[model samples]
Target: MLAPSPLGRVLLHLSNLLVIAFLLLPIAAVTLGALQAEKTLQADTRALLPPEWTLDNFRVILSGGEQRGAIFEQVTYLPDNVKKIRFAFTNSTVIALSVTVLTLAMGALSAWTIARLRYRWTRWLVNASLLARFVPVITLMIPLYVAFRQLGLLNSVVGVIVALTGFLLPYAILILAPYFDQIPKELEDSARIDGCSRFGAFWRVSLPLAAPGLASCGALVFIISWNELLIPLILVNKAEFMTVPVVINSLVGDVHVFFNLMMAICLLALLPSVILVLLLQKFVVAGLQVGGLKG
Candidate 1:
């Protein structure tokens, strides 16, 4: 490939800057909003910045809504939603992590079989996963809610993890299988000729080579499970079982909306997934590129 001309490089840089600005605009607004007091937020509709800055919103949420150090002395009434922060955060972490682990472990094995075996049934299975991806999630809510209620899984984290894992498994397989297919079969064959069983060959040979696919799949699963709102909202009613998104939803009301508080929690909710993606971006790109190019 030839190197780009000067004008081409300038245009490329300008395009990148515009894309970055577009993506960061909402995030910047949320971060700034979270740093200001509620009165300041309401006072200025057109102001580019807050009239006065305060970390009290974050302090209240992180402190479980307790007044501290006389700064929050005037804040007499803390909402029940604020008190649920710790529980909601813990629940979100547990559920997201559980779903990612479950999806990765189960999906990898299934994808491996489908990719390597090349049988008629395996193709059907991949096709079914593709079909599952196309199904509208809202369509399943009613039936899922009824089933969870019957199974006594309505307020349990285990139930949420199971549901998310099932939904995300298809995506994981779609990402992983193609990359697995790209692996040279001669590696596994050599291992097998050396008396390693098929599963052993997979364990020792294929798994290591497929690390990029696994990393990408796990990150995608984690992000999807963490951001998922519909199923959790339908199934979980109690504050004890609520995740971050549901708790955030509860903050919305006709009487009053805590925009600053909501923004603070949202920023908190976004951090883990963002950090995971940044840390594993290389693997994610590698996996996607390989998967797309290969069978």
Candidate 2:
């Protein structure tokens, strides 16, 4: 290949700089906004940096306790039953963890079978699972709500977990199957030759190799379930059962939206997923690339 000219190199650097700037601008704005002293978002004839910064917003929104008529109080106007932000966070954590565990278990088993066993029905189910992912959550909301209510799951954390798992299962299967496919068949065959059952072979040989993929899938599902709003809003109506997104959404209806509190809640919500991604990012990136480019 011909070496780039000086002018071409200059343009390339400028283009790269512009792309970085475009991406960082919104993030910078949000970070600054979150740190601002204003209770509500209002524009002042001031520079990008706020004149004052305070942790009071964080205090009220987070661990700040026992204030009447606050969202954390018995109730304020929100479509959901989340009377308190703390309850919502707890509900979100429980549901998200439950969904992640269930999806990982089911998706890993199903994907392993489809990748290794290679039966006609397994192939069909794999393809069908992918197709199921394309179905919009809206289409199934009414049916799900009715079914969960019939089973006494509505307005409960279990209800949210059950609903989220259905949608997230397909994603786990899709991401994991390719990674399973990448594993060396010889490893499984050797274990089988040593008189290990198929399941045993999978448990001992294949499962270890697929850890990166599982971690990635689990992280994705956790984030998705944590941030979900629509299903939780529709299915749940108990104050203690609201999830984080639903709680933040309720803040919007206030006659004067408390931007500081809202932003603080948002910042807190971002922490768990941020920590997860930071810790497992290498595996996540690798799994995604492999799943996309290979099997």
Candidate 3:
């Protein structure tokens, strides 16, 4: 590769800075909105910054809508879902984790079979997964809702987990199969010779060797499941089972909006996934770079 000329290099740097600002502008606006009072936000849309900032938005939410202080006392018309932030958070966590675990286990087992068996049908299965990936999720929404309702799974976290797992499982198999195909068969052969059955060989040998791929798959699945809105919205009408996205939607109103509180809740909703990605950053990079599973 050749280095750019001086003028070209300057243009590249300027373009990069512009892209960064473009991406970060909404986040900066949200942070600023979360910090200042809603009245101040409304009064000064043209202001670069708020004249006065307050922590009352965070306090009101964290207190479970019980402590609005004298200044915010008139803000008593909170919705039921807004008051149940903690419950919605719990529901989101449980559904995401459950989906991740189920998808990984089933996907790894299927990937191992498809990779090792290498039969004509296995190849067909891989092709089917590719086909499934191209199918629009919204296309399946109505059928899934009716099926779940018939199966007595509606209005439950388990139903959401099952639905998400089914949709996400194909991607998991797609990721893991190529990685598994790359692993030398000698290791599994040695395990079998030592009296390990097929499941034993996979559980003890292949799984550990594919840790990076598994970590990547798990993170992807969990993040998708955590933020899923359509499936949850379709399956659950009860407030008790609402996830963060559904709860957030409930807070929006045509009139008398609370921008600061909304921004604060949005920030809170983003924390878990952000933290999870940061904690598993190394695994994700290693898996994507070396797993050779892009196919």
Candidate 4:
């Protein structure tokens, strides 16, 4: 392997620094906003450093019930529900994990068949999934709303989960199919030669080696489902079913919009996705590299 010249190395380091700064800059701003005194934020040109540190904003929002002031209130107009961040957090976790697991199970099986089975329809199915993934969720919002309303799925956690799964499944199938295709065919063929059944070969051999792809698909689903706002906003009207994004969005309408508290909730809403990426990042990188290189 040939090493890059000195100038190439400098350029590579510069490119990495630029990407890192781009990612961290917004997070740093949000953190500083969360910590600043409410008074300082209200002033013109918000400063990076807080004039005073106070937990009062977080305190007020957490404890104020329907009485708290924040920007999210404009969307939902519920002051009492903000007090139950614990419940919102729980609901978000349940929905996200459930969607991730369901998507992976269905997507993996389908992708495996599409990759290994020699059928003309398999190519069409893969193309169909690609098309579905590109369709904007916003375009389906009104129709989905009416359908869910008729089915009594509106204003329910189950409704949100179903809707999100529908939106995420296509992307999962698209990503995983290519990864499955990249796996060495000889491995499965050898297992079959030993008298193993097709399903047995898949379960015992191929599935284990597809972990990186599975992890990547699962992580993407979790992040998107956790951060989704529009589906939850339309499907669930009750405060009790509200997810974190919906809850955080409901903070806008109070007499005073508590910037500090809003920023704090925003930060909290980001934690699960952050931890997920950190833990599964290796798999994600490997999967992307393999899929990209092959496809």
Candidate 5:
């Protein structure tokens, strides 16, 4: 195909810039908001820049509300959840990591089976997994809530991890199966001929070859689990067990909303996922490209 004309190239560049700006707008708002006091934020509703900036919001959050800086000197109260920010962070980290590990382990096995076995039932299973994605998660919340309550799993990190793992498993399978399918069967056969068992062939040869796909899926799973609100919100009500998203949600009170503090928390919550994606950028891109193509 002929290269685009100069004008067409310019238009494409402009379009790309617009889309990037659209995506970055929220981050900009959050960063700006996080750097200022609530008063400054409210003082100039129309102003793009805050008249003054402060790190007190982060200080208070990081200190677990023990140190009230100049901005919060006169404030009589802070949200309980804001004070427990560390717990939220800990819970979120634990849940996300656990879910990623579990999803990768189980998803790798299932996807490899589905890809290599090519049985009629495996095709049906793939269709079922796809169908699971179509069902709104909200619809399943009630039943899940009831079931977890019966099992005494409510108000626990394990419950949230379980729920998120099941919810995200289908995505892992779908993303990973293509990678496994594209792997040459000869490699596994060679491993088996070298005295490796069927499972040993997978463990030693196929799984290592699917590293890029695993990285991509793990990053996606971690981000999803880290940002998940509904599962934790529905399953866990205790403050100590709450994740970052749940704590962030708690910032909005019935009487007053802590917009500045909330923005600071949002920035903090976004850091892990952003860092993970950046670190795995190459693997993720390569994995996505390979997974999208048919062998």
Candidate 6:
């Protein structure tokens, strides 16, 4: 294929810019909303920008509703959930990390088996795993809720972790199996010939060789788990067990909505996943490239 001419190239660049702007518009809105007081936000819904800016929203949220600052001086009541932002942050971090580790460990082993083993059952298992992703998670919520209630796992961080791991495990397996298959079997064989056990060879050789795939799958898992709201919302109703997304959801009350405060919290909530993706982007891109290539 020939390269595009100057006008075509300019059009392509313009299209890309348009897409980027579309994506960033929400972030820009959130930042602007977080910078201003609620009165300014409501006063001029028609305006593109707030009349004045303040960090009082951040101050109130970070201070757990203690320091109202000038912005919230007249406001008397804050949601109980809003005051427990620290708990939500802690719960989200712990759950995301836990889900990432569990998904990677289980996914790697299962993916390796599916990739290396020729058994019919392994093929069936892989297909089944893929099919699981087709079922809407919402449909399973009721059954999961009942089961967790019976197991006394509701309203706990452990419950959220387990639910997220199960929901995300199939995607991890699909992402990782191709990478494992692309690995040279000779590497594991060499490790095995050096007196390493089968599992040991995999642990030391194949696993490390698949580092990029792991990083890719892990970053994706962490982000999904961090942003997951439905599973946690259904599984854990208690504020102490609430994740960042759950806390953000709590901001929408029946009578009033704290748009500025919610936006500030949203910005805070977005940092970890954004930083994780940025740090792992190279590995993620490489892994995706390798995973997609045929042997």
Candidate 5 per-residue C-alpha lDDT over 1-295 given as tens digits, one digit per residue, 9 for 90 to 100 = 7899999999999999999999999999999989999898777789999888899989999999899999988988877888888999999999999999999999999999999888999888788888886778789899999999999999988888889999888878888998899899999999889999989999999999999789988877887788888889999888899999998777666356468888899999999988887898886666556434221
Q: Report lDDT (CA) for all predictions.
A: 0.84, 0.76, 0.84, 0.79, 0.87, 0.86
Residue 70 displacement in candidate 4 (angstroms): 17
> lDDT (0-100) at residue 89 of candidate 1?
91
Q: List the residue pairs that clash in candidate 2.
A: 81-239
Q: Write the per-residue lDDT of candidate 1 for residues 252-279, one digit (tens) a residue.
A: 7725546887888899989988898789
Q: What is candidate 6's lDDT per residue for 64-172, written digit by digit as tens?
A: 8899999888888888888898999999999999999999999999999888775898888778877887878799899999999999999989888988899888888
Residue-level lDDT tens digits of model 4 in 107-135 = 88889999999588988888888788667
Off by over 4 Å in 2: 1-3, 39-46, 65-83, 287-295
Best by lDDT: 5
lDDT of 2 by residue, 71-128 (tens): 3244343333223777887788888999999999999999999899899998998788
**Lowest-lDDT window of 10 residues in candidate 5?**
286-295
Worst lDDT window (10 residues) for model 6? 286-295
Better of 2 and 3 by TM-score: 3
Please count the clashing residue pairs in each candidate, in the order shown.
0, 1, 0, 17, 0, 0
The positional error of residue 197 in candidate 4, measured at the CA in angstroms, is 1.9
Instruction: Kindly indicate the candidate among 1 and 2 with the higher lDDT.
Output: 1
lDDT (Cα, 0-100) at 187 in candidate 5:
98
Q: Estimate each model's TM-score.
A: 0.90, 0.86, 0.91, 0.83, 0.92, 0.92
TM-score of 4: 0.83
- lDDT score of residue 225 within candidate 3: 85
